[model samples]
Target: MISSAPVIILHGGAGYWEGKNLDSVNSALREASRRGFEEFRRGSSIEAVVEAISFMEDSGVFDAGKGSVKNSEGEVEMDAGIMDGKTLSAGSVVLVRTGSPIRKALEVMKKGKHVIIAERKGNSNTTFNSGKGGDTVGAVALDLEGRIVAGTSTGGISGKEPGRIGDSPIPGAGFYATERVGVSSTGIGEVILRVLPAKEVDTLVSMGILLDDALNSVVNKVSRMFGKGNIGMIGVSKYGDVSAHFNTKGMPRCYQNKEKIQCLVFDGDFS
Candidate 1:
């Protein structure tokens, strides 16, 4: 039988977070990790990821769900994705106006017909931040059954055009899961979509690389391809090992298990 020990990792996003805002981001990351682990203890990896993401969304501490940034037209259009490691089943939604974009993604997974749903038309405009915004939220967990699962949610880039989709709603780009590993990513949606960061890490793990090493390798690749401070990722291997990596100046993140929880505002290697 698998051990009761559970592992969970979560990220608020990657960007220029500092000072007082860093404190709020840290608090939210810690709470999210704690909540996810709680659900993991209940033996549901899926629920753990969902609950953790929902908490972050509701916290209004990150650019997702309730506090999602407005688009060019001053409207909030969110994207989210969820994946199950055991079955490789996945679901995603884009341009959602609901308060729970992550919940909608979960529903898509449960429904199991389509892998994605996207809004059809363009709306109005606003000037949030455009290309410089680094905003996405995600979680990965390993449950007692040894299954790994991952979920990601985002408000899309600041000032993004209405109906524009980002990596958050793309499986293998923002999130990926398999019997071997699970991954979730945050950063520039365009860069992430180009590299499919999550799946790249899993591919390395499948080739016998350690979870941390795989993550580091992917971070290095992104740094070379898109420059530093461009992407961040969190993951869990089926063996309950957890990994988090980013090329950004800061990424609010946390990892937890029965033994203890570790939360940090920036990756040590990045400093």
Candidate 2:
């Protein structure tokens, strides 16, 4: 039987942070940590973690969900993805206006589709309306039952043209997951789309590289291709090992635990 220890991970949207208040951001990080821990304690699967994180993402206070960035046209376009490691199944939606793209993506995954991108123009459905501000957020969970799942969501690039879409909601870009490894990222959408960093990291893991090393290799490659700057990711391996890395000035705070919750924030120089 699989062990009963549950693990949950989350990310605030990824972007350039120059003048933002560190204390306030830390508080938000703590809150997300609390929610994640609580869900884990409640016997909730990674699905619950994704739903709770979506609450954080939807709260206009962060750069995702309702408060997501506006395109050059001043409109929001969103993207998201979800994967079930146990089943090796995944789903994604892109350029959508839904509130919780992550959950919608999970629904699609349960329906047996490997990928499901939300159409810009399609028959009106409430699922497509869940992502309000085009913000993207992602989540991954590993329950004591040994089932793993991953998800990603985003608001499209700031100042992008009306139809411009990045890789946040793409399966291989913003996030990737499998029973063996899990990956999630935040940064330049174009660069992510071009290289499919998340899946690349998974491939590295499949090739026997440790999760942290795989993440570093992928981030380094993207940095070189897109110019070294603020690209970052948070990932956990199948063994419940966690690591965070970035190629730019700094990445935001994140926390993890199977015992008690802890939040780690980096506001200083990248090292």
Tens-place lDDT per residue, model 2, 4-49, is 2476666665555556665665566567666766776666556555
lDDT top scorer: 1
Scored by lDDT, model 1 comes in at 0.82
Native-to-model Cα distance after best TM-score fit, residue 119 in candidate 2, in Å: 4.3
CA lDDT, every model vs. true structure: 0.82, 0.65
Stretches of model 2 off by over 4 angstroms after superposition: 1-4, 41-44, 119-136, 267-271
TM-score quality measure for candidate 2: 0.84
Error of 2 at 225 (Å): 2.6
Clashes found in each candidate (C-alpha, N, C closer than 3 A): 7, 17
